[model samples]
Target: MKNIQRLEMETKGIALSQQELIIYLQENGLQPHEEYNAQSPSAKKAIYQTALSTLESVANNPEMMRNVKMDDMTVSEFHENLTDRIDQLEKKIRGMRTDANQSDFFMLFN
Candidate 1:
């Protein structure tokens, strides 16, 4: 949740409270008592990957791309924004994997 919120805020300037996050997550079957451990790299990666997949779906939708108006955003502008965001998320996920693997590879060299 922290990872998702941080990236969203940094990339899109959108801020969400914990309460709001929990409410929507509940709709997806997430329990309130459930929490993610900061030490779990796989858990964080899975969440990021899921977010990336969802954003990609909307960004790649041809039918939904025509004449769309989201607040003050036009279709082209929205597409452009999504494209930038997708690039950033992909880079972040790749960096996470690379960093993790590099540390593990250090033991092999030793």
Candidate 2:
């Protein structure tokens, strides 16, 4: 078995098979290693690879991005959005209450 220990070690000890690496690349909108003419052993190439991997990890984590984006919002903006959602929910609750009251009245009459 061709264990990719070097690649795994480079990626903070996250061991991934060749197939898994290919899938990861695809999921992260990255081209395969074969597509890049990256055969040379250069420091620049290594740095680029590391940055790209970091980007992939960040992109794949939706919750992290959501938190980061939420953090970027101003307090006022966050409050406004929350208020809008709450208003909508309150409207729904009011409508449901009216509906339930009508059903109860109809049941008592029947």
Every model's TM-score: 0.56, 0.28
lDDT of candidate 2 at residue 1, scale 0 to 100: 11
Looking at model 1, residue 83 earns an lDDT score of 85
**lDDT per residue as tens, model 2, 32-107:** 5533323333322332344345445544555544554454685456445544544554454334432124444445
**Each model's total of backbone clashes:** 0, 0
lDDT score of residue 81 within candidate 2: 53
Which residue ranges in model 1 land beyond 4 Å of their true spot? Answer: 1-34, 66-68, 97-110
Give the best candidate by lDDT: 1
Error of 2 at 103 (Å): 82
Candidate lDDT scores, in order, read: 0.58, 0.43
Task: Please give the range of 10 consecutive residues that has the lowest summed lDDT in model 1.
Answer: 6-15
Cα RMSD to native, each candidate? 6.3, 20.9
Give the Cα-based TM-score of candidate 1 against the true structure: 0.56
Tell me the tens digit of each residue's lDDT in model 1 across 1-110: 45445334333433345564455444433343556445666555555665565566567675766645578888789789888888988998876742246464445464
Q: What's the TM for model 2? A: 0.28
